[model samples]
Target: MAQIVISRFAPSPTGRLHLGHAFSALAAHDAARAAGGRFLLRIEDIDTTRSRPEHVAGIFDDLAWLGLTWDEPPLFQSQRMPLYGKALSDLKALGVLYPCFCTRAEIAAEVAASGFAPHGPDGPLYPGTCRALTPDDRAARLSRDAHSWRLDVDAALALTGPLVWHEGDRAIPADPRIHGDVVLARKDLGTSYHLSVTVDDAAQGITDVVRGVDLFDATHVHRLLQALLNLPTPLYHHHPLLTAPDGARLAKRHGAPSLASMRAEGVDPVTLVADLRARR
Candidate 1:
């Protein structure tokens, strides 16, 4: 018997789904369908401040309208805080997490003043300003000020030794240190994207992670998290992002039209799906 293949398309419900989202969902759905496996939907709504109920409803409606069906009811990130909290506690026991009290302005000033800040895929990497805080200072700050919990990447790498994860048939080496003490929990929310997604994938028994290539760099950090948490590392397939006719990446910020708008303008879902499949 062959191992079951499970993949997911997780989207944050902060805005309406666009053509890029459709392409990603269809890719995952097709991959699972080809393998006679399961395709799951996950609502990445951990950013409660921005996530809207109306947008969440629209996601389900749009996916259904596109003739895509998921095997299981969608998993919402907001509902899985306890699981994330437990993961944080486990990492805390390992002594690899530290409270980072730096505000955004403070971080910016530090990075600007350094004049030679290390850059990561996302831009200038965070300088570990709070990582060196003494126990007494950390305790005092925790008592009065709100702070985020950051992963001590250097410390974590020391314990895990080295880590690698598979992307398709190739085993890629993970260099999570480039990210430099990524926050696992924010001041307002108890969980961050890195922490929530890693924990949820394991809890949901995901076998393959299918998403756009934009998230390829994030896999390095996720791989490290999996090792530290003693969780299974899933196979990763980062498909190319769908771009507009202008050759730019499709983005809501760029005023990319939503699937809902396209549907209302008399575009046929079947034809749209065929076009997307052909592009792939």
Candidate 2:
């Protein structure tokens, strides 16, 4: 038998736990429990514009209703801003971070003019508008106050082992250019997803990350960030996503019954477990 250390379920508290979310949470909890390992929960509420206290409360209720328990007081992303700031400062000190000034509209226009189709999760690749700026030019852009920090792809790539994430068959490589200088901090918040998640996973000592297949690509970026920051790389298992009868994978917009909603309708906890087993 293999030894299990730790696993986690991190859900954005912006929405309720739908079927997809329930499956993910149950998968993590069940795997950890079966292995006699620790299972943890994290509230990914960094996107303040969408995250609500009510939603966070609902997540707790839904998970409890499903008979899932997590170790530790649930980790909240918003409260960890200071840690993220420190990581960003470290990267900046190493000259791997730079500021990005292009707005969404400007990037769109540039993409349209270039006649290139958008690819990947974030749409069109950023054209490196700020990559070649001189010190004075950089200072001028900073003065305009329209910039957000970005990882210098060239420098970031030179730092290896962080960009490697394992799928079942093989390891996938993350080239920073594919992600195109993601924003580490935005004007709206003190930290970005890349920075916060990498820092938190390392700080919490997560050994394995179990989540939906949709996030598989994101692992590449996470691996890169983990390497750049010199954090331990956790094993990843991206499971199949639950889909609606219509064949679309379950999503927040479905309004189709959620796991909590199913519980409210009186479905037994054993039933959920059976359903998970059937799907697998």
Candidate 3:
């Protein structure tokens, strides 16, 4: 019996989907199509402050315009707060999560004062300042202070032992501490990307995770989260990003033009999809 390949393309509704997003969505869709399997769509609108209702509607419209469809209705992260909360509670019971009350400025100052702080994929890692808080102190702070919840990576690894994740048949060693004490829940949102995405993948029974190379390193953290949460890790494909002629990767922050804007300019979705497939 052949194994059914399931892939997903998750996009945040913070902005419109760009060429880079198009390439990723098409890649996942085509992979599932080629395998005669399931392709899922996930709306990663976890950042409530930034996510907009209009952008969510735009996601459906743009994918429809591109003639892309999914095996099931999309999963929305905003509605799954309790699932994430339960995962947090599970980790809390495992004694691997801690309350982090340090603000960004305080963390930066501590790192700067250290003269030689360790760096990760996203600059200086958290220095574990709050990890050393006493129980009574933590409780007192928890009473009045707005704080994020961070995974104690060292403690988590001790519980899971050494770990690895898969990309195709390749078994990449997982560095659980790569992102050092990554936030599992933000002060404002009860869930972070790593925690929510890890939980959702299992919920959707996603078999293959297809995403851009920019997140390749983050997979190490995701792999760790999967282990801690006792969820299955999916096979991964981190595709190279589509970049501008000047060599910058296409991104919303860089003001990359979106598929909706392109369509408004009379760009043919069929032609664009064909071009994207050729590039793939």
Candidate 4:
């Protein structure tokens, strides 16, 4: 008997579902359907400040209008804070997490003053400013100021040694240090994307992690977290992003027409699905 293939398309409810989102959701859904397996939907509403209930409703409407269906009701990240907390606690027990006190402005100033900040997939990597804080200093600051919990990548790598993850038939080496000490939980939200997604994927038994190639770099960090948390690493499928006629990637910021707008304009869902499948 073959192993069951489970895939997911977890989208944040920060904005309307655009063309790129459709492409990604369809890719994950089609892959699962093709394998006679399960496709799951997850609402990544960890950013409480920006996440909107209306946008989440829009996501469901858009995916349904595109003729896509999920195996279960969507998993909302906002409701899984306890699970993320447990993962963070486990990492902390392993001495692989520390409080990061640097604000965004501070991080930028440090990077700018360095004059040669090494760039990662997300632009200038964090400078590890708070990684060297003494226990007393950390305690003192914690008493008054807010701080994020960051994964001590160097320490984590020391424990896990080296790691690799499967992307199709190829084994890719993970280089999570490129991200420096990534925040596992924020001062305000209490959970970060890296921590929540890694935990949820495992919890949901997601066997095949499918998403846009833009998140390929994020897999390195996710793989490391899996090792530290004693979770199973899933097979990855980082598909190419759909682009507009101008050859630029479709994005919410780029004013890409949303699926809702297309629906309102009387575009046929079947025709749209066929067009997207052709692009793949």
Whose TM-score is greatest here? 1
User: lDDT per prediction?
Assistant: 0.94, 0.81, 0.92, 0.93
- lDDT of candidate model 3 versus the reference: 0.92
Candidate order by lDDT, decreasing, is: 1, 4, 3, 2
Q: Is 1 or 4 the stronger prediction by lDDT? A: 1
Candidate 2 residue lDDT tens string, 134-252: 87889987887767887777787775533567664577776556677778888678788878888999998988888888877777778878877889888888889988878988887
* Candidate 4 stretches greater than 4 Å from native: none
- Regions of model 1 farther than 4 Å from truth: none
Which pairs in model 3 have colliding backbones?
A: none
Tell me each candidate's TM-score: 0.99, 0.92, 0.98, 0.98
Give candidate 4's whole-model lDDT: 0.93
lDDT of 3 by residue, 109-154 (tens): 9999999988998999999999999999999999999999999999
Each candidate's number of clashing pairs is: 0, 2, 0, 0
